[model samples]
Target: MGGMIIVEEGALRIVGGLVDGRPVAIVQEADDVLFRVSGNSIEDAVAVARARLGAGGGVPSQRAPVDVPVDAAAPTPSVPPRDLRALLRAAVAAFDPLRSEGVTEGPGKDRYRKIYVAGWPALVHYEFLPSHARRHMGVELHVETEKAAAVTGILPALCAVVRDAMPGQAVVHDPNWVGGCGRLQVVFPDTATADTLARAMQQLIVLTRPRVEAALH
Candidate 1:
């Protein structure tokens, strides 16, 4: 009621592509509502989604506010209470606060809104913006290469390594592909833990960056 979005579940028509910006998606069914949100933990968001989606409805008859909050300064005694997107945005701020999400251009030189943010348990291409957030932890690691296409080759391995490195406390998201570059998110459970692991990753990238640069070149 407060934060969750109530999108009438149905096979909505999605038209326009190639030249037009419309890309259709049949998210849920007609009878049930589809609750999309971003949050620190995938489980937290999913929990709320299930509850809200299960609560049948037409419209609230009242506009509700999104539940996501902001935390400019991170690493508090407790996990920052924010939705998934806000938490990712906070992580992005720690690395490059000034950088704009900017715009995206497609095959036909058509432009649209674009932001480089990490998504997990769900990809941004799937259209997810959570109403609330739990908390997140991870290292702010950025990878730069000559060709963004290079991500295609190393992403799987990188994800695996990052997962193995952080184990359960990880959610690597935000694989940016623009300006001939890409970015990665290496989330951890806490600051100290993430810092130690992030250092190791930094050392590893020193060796891996060259190969990706050379291969892409």
Candidate 2:
């Protein structure tokens, strides 16, 4: 069993097992292990721990006792640090429409990846800004199609639909965006947490998909 270390909305815990005989601490949001760190001592592990807000929501105020297993017979399974694609995967999983419709991830380079549902006119993308910290990434919905009619005719209406649904959001209609592929998207704040970003993308997908389908018909 894991014992609480940082007891708040996004919780971290020291698992019972050790890695290479070193204590391990992990940031777990429900079943998904968002991050992991290990060091010679418990304090070392905690010092380097960085995590996203857990899906579980909140944690108990009290810190539970950590029961580190005495047996060093075998090491715990190592959880590699999460990358951009992993973050996108979490965001996709948070939304039922994306998960149910089945999204595909295109080959990504550096800090960007393209994700889309089968037969959908719009594609979801996440890109990390060089000026911003790693957590401060940008998520966008691009209306990509070979037909000029879709870009010239349908994009403005789609942008209006999204802006109407998400008032106060800085939704934009960029005809020249992404080399004139054009898109309607809102960039999330740099300060937004992982959970917040995921929720924002989920909201966009739910609001935009119907209008996109309506246009296609």
Candidate 3:
């Protein structure tokens, strides 16, 4: 009902309408009462209008549809979650010193098994803490130095630096100053994956070694 074209001697009007549920544009002309043109879609209407007006050089060329590969659209495989104990074992096995010389159990059951860091008085270790329901793991560096106060004093700054570079929280604990011992620990949840633990431990060692060495000096 909307498609209508009115022609006068010097003026013309074109009205738009729908054809088979798709919108169409009506084309008209001035100066001469010529034939009308209609298009099913806006693009078709625009093309018809341009062709009628002698614009856009000529009718627009049609482009061929592109074909996509099936393999390119396929979903990738996901990595399965690892068991806690197995993940911990994998993380411990990743350490170079532990792989070469093996680990030595500490004095008590809760304490970490020591892995010596070459050319330093400090030793690296890993321990698992089990509570009533939850469990936590820690990768720690214990330094044996006579100046316990000096080591503890530099720890805050060192912890700040290490925290910025690492994933887990960095903590310093000095329970027995008489023995000239203190520990710098990176704590992570037991639910963490082997890869995550391994990467965190590696980052902890890299960030902590130079700081502990400087503290000892």
Candidate 4:
């Protein structure tokens, strides 16, 4: 109300200004008041309108202060909060440019793409799966070769190496694929920092690439 306000003839029309780039509108009838505020609950919208009106004159003004106090507004987020995909992307981007390049959004919203590890035939993939409150990060190595049987045969040893290399990480050999294709996958909780995840992925590739190349040969 201190900033600006507007009033209409129908019922009790109170139009609050924009808070955080979202408009807040309040309409009061004889019994109850209805509020429409973007990104905020009805109670919050009413509180904001009342506070603004009290601060300024009872008459609504065109210019109203919509900025809520920091304490009263939504809580601030921690760095790299629960967005595993975004964190993975940042990690790949910060890795050595020569070895890895091109981090783009994947086919799905929860996936990241174009993650290239040095000496690896195919680009790596990262995806985030949410289960309840926990978030899981999936790293995949799509091993495509003419000798699909050979690649499939070495999956056990490759998985063993991956398990040893990435302690506490879950490694699986996913055989479900089209012709001449398989995947070596690793899933782990996304609790580590971006740099840590990036290093883990790079090391995983380094440990497994030789085995894959040998199988191809």
Q: Native-vs-model 2 lDDT? A: 0.47
Mind giving the per-residue lDDT tens digits that candidate 4 earns over 17-103?
334334455544322345444326433454565554453345554444343322112212232336766765665565445243443
At residue 183, give the lDDT of candidate 2: 65
User: Which candidate number has the best lDDT?
Assistant: 4
lDDT of 2 by residue, 164-202 (tens): 776444444566765666665554433334565566666
Between candidates 2 and 3, name the one with more favorable TM-score.
Answer: 2
C-alpha lDDT values of all predictions: 0.32, 0.47, 0.44, 0.49
Task: Please count the clashing residue pairs in each candidate, in the order shown.
Answer: 17, 0, 0, 8
RMSD of 1: 15.3
State, as a TM-score between 0 and 1, how close model 1 is to the true structure: 0.34
- Listed in order, each prediction's TM-score against the native is 0.34, 0.46, 0.44, 0.47
Q: What is the full ranking by lDDT, best candidate first?
A: 4, 2, 3, 1
* Per-residue C-alpha lDDT of model 1 across residues 114-215, encoded as one tens digit per residue: 233322111111111222222333333334444345544565455556545543332233445434244444433222232343343343344344444454
lDDT of 3 by residue, 69-133 (tens): 22111111222322445545566656544332223333333333455545444333333322212
For candidate 4, list the clashing residue pairs, or say none.
Answer: 3-63, 3-64, 4-61, 4-62, 4-63, 4-64, 5-61, 5-62
Off by over 4 Å in 4: 1-81, 97-110, 116-134, 144-147, 177-180
